[model samples]
Target chain A: MHNLEAILAMGLVTLLCRATPFIFFMKRKPPAVLDFVQRYIPPMIMTILVLNSFKGLRFGLAPFGLPEIASALAVAALQLWRRNALISIVGGTGLYMLLIRVL
Target chain B: MHSNSEAPRVKVLGPAFTASIPVLLGYSTIGIAFGLLVVKAGLPWFLSPVMSIVIYAGAAQFMAIALLAAGTDIVQMAILTLVINARHMVYGLSLLDRFAVCRRWKGYLIYALTDETYGLLTTVSPPEGARSESFYAAVSALDESYWVAGSLVGAVIGGLVPTEYTKGLDFALTALFVVLLVEQIRSIRRIEPYAIATAATVLAFVLFGPANLLVIAILASIAGILAFRRRLP
Candidate 1:
């Protein structure tokens, strides 16, 4: 029941979410201050997200563990190697899962 | 700028509908994962779509599911959702350029300024002398259509599939992030983002416990950015 509700609700929200921005800003470009803010903001937000998503403080050999840290490294390498979003995801997640179970 | 007085409306609408195909495919995968998570969290599957429509934030939606599962209060859920998605405030900032033109549509744009759409728009500057609003509208519609379709597909699958198979589906979010970050790193000549992310992540894990690490990460990254601002250009 919950799944069903989530599916329907999320579907509409997703549509509206995608639509609202264009609907509002389709006619204009952001100001200089906004451009500046956009430039610097994502790094901070992403940093916070990555830190909070971690499972543990200490892992096998170092502070970073096999799951997230390894995945992060994989993402960086793959991005440098391929420059493709889908490929990096597959490589990073696949490697992370395999490492968690194997090592 | 080509005005509606000269250009046909269908000309603008056609591209928006067509571009949604790829967006739809990506949304489907994530939507399915979300559907599965909501169900696993023991919330009514039907209600998931409602929240998805209203809140419309991917990360926040997932967080909402977790909160709902834990029986979190409604007020707490709302506040947390707002905090987690505060990044959208920046997204809004970027849209100000295009948004100022469509005075009547401001309300809807504020509602729909999502991460994916923002990613697509901010990176792609419109051609000069073109009617940007039409193009923007098309992209926005395409993105929304994809998301809606994805959620619907997820719900249908959730209704049919067994619970065990869906257990591992929540991974789509992390996988998506990994992919996006990788893309960012690929084109990024400035290593500051990488350095900041790494240093902040390490410092956060060390000084603060995992729970408080998010705040530390934000601080460290900001500090890094401030320190290196002169080198950005």
Candidate 2:
């Protein structure tokens, strides 16, 4: 019940975030902040998220974060080259899975 | 007469399904990863499908696993979900005109407006003679079903596998973010946002540690962007 409550709360908040613009800005012109966020926040958030994904890595220890960095660069390079998200993700993740064990 | 009349329905349905193929691939894989993560984090497998069906936000659902593992309170969980999913607000803003055609299904369409679904809806047009609302609804429903089905599969697999075998599988999430980041970069073709985000992330990690890193970094990035707004272009 507790876990369900938490999940539902998150679901409600997510719905709120998604629906806010449709609810509030349907008729009136949206604020400048909305435009600013649309233009800037997306890329910023993406960068932050990619970096955040590395939060669990141990930089000072063995392998020295190489697996994470190498795998991420592989993901980026493959994405840039193929432009196919699925292939890039699978390839990068496969390499990471192999690398963490071998290295 | 029957085949002739059913022909038009096929025309609409076929193109919509084709358009959803890319999303079907992306969502299923990522959704599976999320499901494995939920079980790996010590939660019940059933919660995987529940989160996918209810929250339906990929990044937030992944974050929820971590939040639950940490035993975070409902209020904090809600706030984090809000921050992570704030981008959906912009998505809804851009979608208003397109979704206006969705009279009966507009509410459901808005609820299911994810990053991939938004991209497809905005870019891909319905085939000739098809209703736009029907096209949107089909794509939305198909994408969510793929996600839910994929998560269910992963959750079951997670329960069976030795935990060690799934060790580096979470890298799938990182790879997803990287792929998305590359796409974002291609579209924006700007440097300031990336630079500000990097700085904000470093500052947050050093000052606050990873505990509050994402929220603080996001706030700092917003401040940094606002301060340099005039010079951006």
Candidate 3:
């Protein structure tokens, strides 16, 4: 019951967050802040999300986040070269999986 | 007449499916990991799919495993979920223009806007003849199905697969983000947001630790953008 309650609460909270903008701005003109966020924040948030993915890395350790850095660079490079999302993701993830095992 | 009505819907489906392929890969892999983690954490296997269907947020669902294990209270869990998912509000803000035309599917679109779905929607343009709302709905529903299916598979076979083989499969999520970030960079064609976000993330990590990294970094980045708005292109 407790687990169920927690799940429901989390779900409600998440839906609320996702819905907040639509609820507020559905009928009115969104403020200038909306334009600012829409214009500049997508890339900013994406960059942060990409960086946050490395939160578990141990930078001070022996490998020193090398696998993550190398794999991310591979993904970015592949994406830049081929412009295919699947190829870049699969190639990068495959390389990371191999690197983690061997390194 | 029926074929005429159906033609553009068919056209939208193709591009929507193509755009969602990366998310299919990423969500399935990560969803499986979440299921495995849930079972490994000694929670009932059913909760994995339940959470996937209900919460539908990847990081928050993962965090819920730890929270449940620690016996965290419901209110606290809800609060943390809001904080963790706060970036989604920004996603909603960015999507206003795109979703403005989606009156019929607006509610479902809002509910299904996971990180990967949001990325795909923001980056991929609807085909010329198809309705944008229909395209958005297709991508969102397809992504959610992939997630639920993956989680169910993982839950059913939770203990069967050896942990070693699945070690870095979660990297697919990061790779997805990197691909999306590259797309964002390409379209935006500006360095300020990227630089500001990176700086803010580093600052947040160093100052507040990883526990509060995302929200703090997002707040700082928003502030940074506002401060430098005049100079930005």
Candidate 4:
């Protein structure tokens, strides 16, 4: 069985991530350094996460991880065209699901 | 005067609930998928709801199922959770002015700022005569309730399903993050952050393999950007 205490600890950590800025910034503005970080941190993080999702794909293997790469490109294209997050996500996930089944 | 105050509060919630419908749909399905993964990892079915109610970070909680099942230590799990949810802290940066008017409700708003909630909260304005405090709280609470309810339902569904049936459920996470990335890229026309993130991640992955590379990439990207901030937009 997974440790329930550990799960709760994870919960505490998440709450900390979500809450610390509010507590710290309540009385005063965030420092200039933080302001700079905030401006650039988000896009950087999102970009890394997108690449990180494709962490380990053996190029020589069958299916060759085509499903992940294809679906990601498709999702990006659909998002760029439709500009709707829900549509892009659902459509791309649907495509990925289909590809996994067929390939 | 109390009765007069309560009426707009009621009207306030109507739009907040309406605005949250999209999150309702997204969270319910994604939340169910998340709950199923937790159960698949051999936890008791009800633990899904508990985690959903408490941890509530979409990808972080999903990652937890794997890390916990693998018997990873608390410090690693803690750091992993922090790294995955780090972007959330900045969502509050944008909300400083929006949430400043709130008193009692601000705590709840801060606690519930998930990616979906933050996206919605930032785009929409409050309805006429509706206090921003109640409006924001209603959006946050409604989105959270969808997640909690979906987890309960997904847990029950997880109990009934065969393991193979949920095979592609994890793709939903990849799809969600990619969608967010695309949105971020589109919103900001600058190419520097994208270039920095790509270079840092590729360097880290090559140097350290897949294990804990994100933390390194994030740190590298942060320092990289700060040093070059003057030259780039």
Candidate 2 lDDT score relative to the true structure: 0.80
Query: Which runs of model 1 end up more than 4 angstroms from their true locations?
Result: A1-37, A42-103, B1-27, B37-43, B66-72, B98-109, B124-143, B162-188, B205-216, B229-232
Task: Give per-residue CA lDDT, model 4, range A1-103, as digits (tens).
Answer: 4467778888888888787778788788677776676677667877887788788777689899999999988888998899776677778877887888899
Docking class of 4: medium
> How does model 1 score on DockQ?
0.21
Q: What is the lDDT of residue B127 in candidate 4?
A: 93
Clashing pairs in 2: none
User: Which regions in candidate 4 have their CA more than 4 angstroms from the true location?
Assistant: A1-6, B1-42, B58-98, B101-104, B115-139, B162-170
Comparing to the true complex, what docking class would candidate 2 get?
medium
The alpha-carbon RMSD over the true interface for every model, in angstroms, is 5.9, 3.8, 1.5, 3.7
Clashing pairs in 4: none
As for candidate 1, its interface RMSD to one decimal place is 5.9
The TM-score values for the models, in the order shown, are 0.62, 0.72, 0.93, 0.75
Ranking by TM-score: 3, 4, 2, 1
The residue-level lDDT of candidate 4 at B204 comes to 92
List model 4 lDDT by residue over B17-114, tens digit each: 87676567567777777788878788778888888877887778888888878889888888888877775665676677678788988878888888
For model 3, the stretches where C-alpha displacement exceeds 4 angstroms are: B1-5, B69-71
* Model 2 lDDT tens row, B1-233: 66554565566667777666656656666677788888889999999999998999887898899888888899999988887787677567667667766688899998898866776675566888777887888889988998999899889884564547656766765676777788888888888999999999999999888875776887788889888877875
- Candidate 1, residue A53: Cα displacement in angstroms equals 6.4
Best by DockQ: 3
* TM-score of chain A in every predicted structure: 0.54, 0.77, 0.91, 0.76
